[model samples]
Target: MSKSQATPNSAATGAESPDAILFREGMSRAAAAVHVVTTDGEAGRAGFTATAVTPVTDSPASLLVCVNTASRSAQALLANRAFCVNTLGAEDLALADIFAGRTGLQGQDRFTVGAWEKLETGSPALTTSLVSFDCRISDARVVATHHVIIGEIVGIRLGERKPPLIYQGRHYHKL
Candidate 1:
């Protein structure tokens, strides 16, 4: 089964313990889309992969993205108040790993994984990504280990026929 679709009661199948039931349930219920959030401002250029993006409103065109409070990209995005969401293609796994810290790239260096450019909003966007959304911060809130950042999309770039890259259960794929 796909990691995002893992059975919640694996232990019922004799594969996990009851204590981990809630944790497994969390994994099972989390259906996410992987996207790279990028920014460039006084803090310099930076990008990070996230699966926490979600649409919030259609009329005003807002999206919510949860970012780890401790990440550099998170810090930069907050400071900039502008970011680009680069939806990856199936072959962009390496780029995903690079931005996600799985490939050892850090800070601004992570942006070198692929071709990048900028949109009208001055947000850095991946040139070969399946789609890119340039956004401006509308509001934000810090809750526990993550920051819920809401943005209003001001521009968009949709690429050619490219499938999206996905991440779940610490694995990557497309479908």
Candidate 2:
């Protein structure tokens, strides 16, 4: 059968149904870069590891970052109206784990584990990140259990060229 001519089961239900499991499983096969999204302001300093980030357009130099609405950093990200997407290098796995909440760290404590500096938005940017995009939140929309944040690039920091940290099939890979 041609690629698009084949169809999987069509009896799947809604997001909370078995289809959700299947959907997650399917997504696991796709490789994505790992990043630590950080924000700091009146709300507070907060950061989290995530893979759900992408460029939306270059005309405006914007990107989208998806954060769970219940994430510890959500409030700060919204209140600050800005963030920094720190793309990790392969050597930053432990940093990613700390931000991912695997180390039981919270809020500013996560920053203690990494080297950080402030960028255009005054958001904490990773000094050792492969690259960091400092941005201002242009818009935010809630979808399912997460907030899709639209960020307009205000500044960008490029670090040394190195293998990036990637996630696929529930594991981290360097490339």
Best by TM-score: 2
Estimate every model's Cα lDDT from 0 to 1. 0.83, 0.91
lDDT of 2 by residue, 58-136 (tens): 9899999999999979888999999999999999999999999998887788888878999989999898899999999
Weakest 10 consecutive residues, lDDT, candidate 1? Answer: 16-25
Which residue pairs in candidate 1 have backbone atoms (N, alpha carbon, C) closer than 3 angstroms, thus clashing? none
Q: Over the stretch 24-57, how does candidate 1's per-residue lDDT look in tens digits?
A: 5566566567899998888778888888898899
The candidate 2 region of ten consecutive residues with least summed lDDT is: 10-19
